[model samples]
Target: MTRSVYVTGIGRSDGRQVVELGVMELLTRQVDRVGVFRPLVHDEPDELYDLLRSRYRLTQPASSVFGMGYEEAAALQAEQGTDELISRLVDRYHQVSDAYEAVLVLGTDFADTGLPAELALNARLANEFGAAVLPVVAARDQAPEAVVAEVRNAHDAYASLGADLIAMVANRVADPEAAAAVRGLAERLPEPVFVLPEEPALAAPTVAQVKEATAAKILLGDHAGLSRDVRNLVFGGAHLPVFLPALTEGCLVVTPGDRSDLLIGALAAHSAGSPAIAGVLLTLDERPDDQTLALAARLAPGTPVLVVPEGSMPTADALLSLEGKLTAATPRKAEIALGLFETHVDAAQLSAQLSVERSERVTPMMFEHELVERSRAARRHIVLPEGTEERVLRAAEVLLRRNICDLTLLGDPAVIRKRAAELSIGLDLPAGDETPADPLSGPGGATARIVDPQTSPLRERFAEVYAALRAHKGVTYELAHDVVSDVSYFGTLMVNEGLADGMVSGAVHSTAATVRPAFEIIRTRPDASIVSSVFFMCLADRVLVYGDCAVVPDPGAEQLADIAIQSATTAARFGVEPRVAMLSYSTGTSGSGADVDKVRRATELVRERRPDLLTEGPIQYDAAVEPSVAATKLPGSAVAGQATVLVFPDLNTGNNTYKAVQRSAGAIAVGPVLQGLRKPVNDLSRGALVQDIVNTVAITAVQAQDAFPHGSGG
Candidate 1:
């Protein structure tokens, strides 16, 4: 039987979407194939449905997600009675249930449904679907006793209707006494009751929402700025001194565009980190002069500046009507929501109650999650040379928030902080008056160490070490000293000298600029013969390892074997079983060429060296991946169609093939992760995004864990 949970609410404004999202998160963590079904949806597309599909990476089509439109369901219920409506919905529910291991049934919203017994309808649907019910009751603006009464009533209503009750949730409780009252009720009720307090940020309107509501023109700001929440509204009508006091954190300043004094003052305050504002909304559509606008851009590079035609009063009225929705675009709010849910609710107990079975196959999301979890288990410090890059700083914020790894950002401390401020990122630096034991301690107890290569005390030590390591290569002390000041060399030395566990660079530098330092300093492992690279190509269903993609432009038979062996080791280390496939233009001796012969030789070498590893060689791409093609081309081969690690004959083929598959098939290529290094030093693409940086950092941290089994310091 399919295990299903029905998330139903007693009334409108209950904020049940949070509970639904939280449940989905738990379900995804448990099962790989989780489906969502909305019994009755509006004619317009569902925002929450889109959010779940995007965030959870659901493959189910949108038409299959809901039973029917609310209007259609209402008409059916009216014409043929409620029995027929329930019958149709039950059939639709069964379709979703049969397809998935678990189904999350979203109940009807009580708002404007034109139905007199919406709660009873939800209970009936839950009963018909044979699903466990989790009911949410809104306690907003209610007293403690009223809130308690509402919870009891909601539970009884569902129970009386013969619904299979799993638990109860009291959402949006504002009063402290009400919150306490709900907690007390949890003990009295038969089922567990989770009480969540009102979070203003969840309800706060984003800059994009405000712009949409007022039809405002975006004069400045990027998508990142537009997603910022407007927690407060400050009218900029007073003098600079007086208006400055009203500037609160995440406040949206509303003033005329001609008020350059107020605009510049707010920008300056935001740059100084004195309660950084969300944005500045200019009324009357009056924009500042070009010079003033340029100055504002310099002050806060990504801060949103919106221009509206309405006056302040009308704009405030429009803003008051806006509310935040949990959509795919508002990812930060989703994070905040999940954090709140995890903090307040006992997720472990809830998951246990759901009884969702774990999946055996590893999905792309599961693989990514495992990477983060593994890295977090043994936290390692990773040094990033491109610290001042906007994407790097943003990635640092995500890394610190998730507690995945400690970071050492190599650059000028002041310049990094200034750039971070311009990007509206919080570095969590210590107070100016206080000095900490570790100079790298950031806000919220995360360590984000910043070091200037030129001024760091370790510069001379690094120079001496570099000169000693490269003495055979004719490197002089003066040349080593000059090179030590470079961020890449400095970062590599940190890993070599045991200051950091690993290093990830090359966001803005060339591949050579990033890897040359590691080659000179860290070198290759004792067991490895040649340095190589592999990219973890994350396809829709699974992840495959592609090797020799970035390094080693041309590998002879010996180098090709070394690359295959190294890639197989990397794949196995990262939870991918190694079924090595030596790819070529020919398959099973049907065609002969230099490339095919090289691949065949490499395959022979791998078999001779590691007989325990499953490998096939001189196979075409289609035969290596597709079972049907394998049956025709190379039947009875052990690793023909099931190869997890593909070894390209040379760099050109590997690089071009990985990129073609990535762009054409919508796959995420994680690397260019350099293998065979004595210490882990991975390089990022010059166009890496924030998540890319985060994933690379996580990968580097995991590699560091392998490098140092017993502790960080080698």
Candidate 2:
């Protein structure tokens, strides 16, 4: 996607320089198409554009998605009709958009204060063509809130007219705190926040941010979260001077321990107010000695301290995790520290993972539980908890009245009504017929005849078998026998046919009771292997993916390999790069036997199968980390340790292991988020937390998007 902005008047040359520089930086990061447009240029096309075009070999005539060749654009003024002028601008926008993924419509400086009208036209055009509009607000030393307010007003105006504003890019941010405050203020607004830190383009931390994001807290001192303008410095043993000056405020420093001079220089620069001191983290694993402590005390006093035992913390593999991230915020500060931590989190790493723009693709499918949300338009049976509390019953009542889902209860309708009335909780399930029917057949009605075995769609699909069954004189009875093994038999039938998209049961049944019918009838996806589960491990920095907690037995090396690959693929779909580690009781080559061998062999197989994947195996939790240990054991393996996606050899290890990690390590498990399904189908724990329900729905939607990439989830 590419966006090009047009400008007729920059208050001054410096203003023009700032505007062009900021615009180019933001656009280059976000889009592939970069061009400029000026419909009625009274003067030379902005000098900055010329400089950029000349420097970058960009084409000229300044043709943009909105074609405003200076000659014809100048005639628009002499043209009598306003509608005609607007129509031409709109047509040009369409032409430009066709050639690009997106177009940034820049308003012109119509000398007669026609800038607003031009902007309105641009907004209308953007709305018509579905372009993301991000108004660029240029300011210098202004109140943070004022800049935010102006951008928000413009955003609201566009949104009110049926357009979505992606974000606002502030030009010439001078104060670090004010810029941070501006970002903070804008996030509170309905729109997303994108801040351009004040720094030279050559010194931006784009690469470092990418590394931080991909590594998922593997590296420290990458504070791209606070500053958009962070540039890496090329240095050897002695170029600390150049590096120190270029270190903008809030920039993260990632240097080797042997490069003590650079570290000291960074600390000295921060001491001198060169920029904001985000945090300083040592990358090596050797415990801090007197010298290291002294240096850290002098340079990073009170700053959050983190040590990544990943030996040398510069690898291309670690940087790929940032493939789709839009901002310079490092994964540590943005996602891990701030996004994960509700309050004050580790400041040292917060810059790397500070929350920024997430994936923009909207999911096409709803969760199994969310089916009730569509009840208003269709008649359906929804299963609720058998012994639901008053609050839950009341909520169900509201849902029923709103047509969210057709209410279905397993208990007697009369008893349910009496209870609901007694507790002041209303419900519609109580009004339905309470009479029990035959298990094999459905509700008695004309619909029953439509479900005849010979004339049914199932008959056509299973014709030979049906004929043979008829010959046997009792085969249909046998097929119908498996229909209702429990009280929720009718609900299972909805899932069998496509009458209902899915069913949510198990609030009152055991896991076996809830899943047996599904396994017998609904069945597993055709391509799926053994069913498996993964918990949505919500950690401080990013979400952790744990698997096989609910299914699978002692998976062989191949099964383990498949689990790793499937988990990694799922993580990628969710915008997370997988660093898979096939965990065993042993670390390195210390232990032998089927278990360790399985991990070792599986790790190799995963690498061979998916050359693009990052993985390691037979690694102890500590050795996979603790850089000192990793360096000693696996001298030079790419994914020697510090793995993110942990694949256990069997369900026993996967289940028990994740539970221990949660209880002992204080990690919150968001799922047993099921994986390897054809659709976004998830099984709920009997005692599910409310947040779990919400997250499952979100995951279901995400999976639905994956299942139906073309928006055909329904």
Candidate 3:
């Protein structure tokens, strides 16, 4: 079997080529027959892959390595579907995988935007290829906590999806803080995590890179000067003495072509061994006199002097935007990257893991990947009650890794730390800050804090608030104080207080335990008379929304209609087209019974309330899902077989059907997601796996995004 790794990033301009080169180094060392694959690319050729081919002497043809352009893939997806797009890419991947002992798959980098969609597509491609996911997190000058958080979340996301596990790397970390970041990640992450400090030499853009960016004319230059890493740019708008002082080593000097004085002064300084500058860029498409140019060249032999048509400001913009590339031309950068990777990572352990079965076993992919992508689009914060539970810890790692949303885990700080260390979760144990920084502001990466309800400063305040809210029931502050100490209550209070946008509980707790606090504190949205729950049934080909599965018991016709409306909205919000099926034992008017009548009436109510929705009711399960069954039983009905939202008559029917599909069909059921809440709060099954917790947490974050668009959760 071919051992493969998918190298990708969650954000744009992540500077992941270093990790890609490092992995290529690892793969070539492990096996002589190494192949490279890039699933999607922009219009231009990939510089890094070209470098790999030249350097590694790989025999695999470009046709095998390059799948298709992003535009081509998008066109295919529009014409066909994502399934067809992935199918072709998977076939392309196997061509390389079958021919090589080891393969390295590079992800896409578009000429433009759409990062969230691209990241999700990359993840799906990784899964369809059955490759172990290796995500490179860029931590360029971000806080130490953010760096570790990003790595952990990335690991968590892929790991929860049941992708073959590989270690994570936090690359391009600021050098001064890298050691501290490494030490902090020693205990929290559940997987092997490595930190690569930023290398200035590698980050410095070369004269060639600047020229490419500015489209300048190289008036006079040699290979050495052009290849020199440009560390800083010095605008020569000052006198000779003033500019001489600013002429630091590796600085790119930008001046008017006529500024022979500034040019000669800079090169004279370099000649006097004040460290060689990265050559001078002449602006306004002008050049010095031949005599002065000759003098400048002699002062620093073979110095690059380029001229651009743009003014100082435009040239400055180009220089500032340029970053060094690790192409075949820059073997030094490749060496530096490999050194960093080898220094921080255990290559032997990685090799052993690469030999695992993840490369050959492709699992079904849909809900989990899309769930995460949607939540990240508009970030929100969610609190988890069972902080010390292994499943919750793992789920938190993935959520924070993607910086999916901010998270607060309610539990004892020490226990959470110990448990996280035991599980090897890469958390760095986010400090018990009273409140986390805003995740929506930038990609700083989200984090989770372990707040012990017993000692939380907000506990008493929450108790008093709860007492006042429930005082009509004769609840006292003393009684509320005891209840608020429970993790579930504490987390819900966090949501109610706008401390967290939403809450996800019940990995170790019960559904009643999770939702009871929400029912009491979070309450119902003003538009809703009652709260309901829906399960997103992620079948192999599509997602089906199942409603009233875990909330209302035996709801009347009105409540059933409300569930249908809520479920349809939830389905639409999550990208599923809302074709509602009011489920019962009977189909249409084929049968006459009380249950069927209730469904028919509920469906009618749904149509009345949400006149825009496509709803059909009193439909059997087979007719609602299988097109063949729908055609025979309820012919010409638009929603008979195309239903994306299924509203059961009551909790018994919804809950049992969801579980049966979850167990028997091997579908991923993400929910019991509560709808019509003033704020977002959700529950998990006690038997929920790590992936289930991950899915539910993502759903909660997305819901929170909807609820708290204005503030934290207020």
Among the numbered candidates, top TM-score falls to 1
Q: What lDDT tens digits, residue by residue, belong to model 1 across residues 384-479? A: 888888788878866775667888887777677666644445456433321112556543244777877888878888999999999998998899
Tens-digit lDDT string for candidate 2 (1-714): 343343222222113233333344334333344455433344433543454554333443455523454445536645655556657766766666566532334445434433335556556656554555555555556777766665566666666776556555455567776677767776577655555443233223343343444342422232322223233322223477666666654444555445666666766665554543444434554345567657755664443333445554353234322222222222211211111111112222221222223223211111211322222223333343342443334434333333333333444444555444333232323233442121112111101101222223443343343334344555454565443323444444434543333444444466566555455445666755656667756443345567667777888878778888888876666545577777788877789998788889988988899989988778876665456777877767566545556677888877887778777875556556556654334555666643344344345445544454543212
TM-score of model number 1: 0.87
TM-scores of the candidates in the order shown: 0.87, 0.40, 0.54
List candidate 2 segments past 4 Å from native.
1-482, 485-493, 503-505, 625-632, 635-641, 709-714
TM-score of 2: 0.40
Deviation in Å, model 1, residue 430 alpha carbon:
4.7
| 1 against 2, candidate with superior TM-score | 1
Query: lDDT per residue, candidate 3, 458-525, as tens digits?
Result: 88899999999899999999999998999889888888888888889888888889888888888999
Pick out the ten consecutive residues of candidate 1 with the lowest summed lDDT: 429-438
Give model 2 RMSD, 1 decimal: 24.5
Q: Assess candidate 2 and give its lDDT.
A: 0.48
Clashing pairs in model 1, backbone N/Cα/C closer than 3 A: 428-443
- Candidate ranking (TM-score, best to worst): 1, 3, 2
Best by lDDT: 1
Model 3 segments more than 4 A misplaced: 1-366, 430-444
What's the count of clashing pairs in each model shown?
Answer: 1, 38, 11
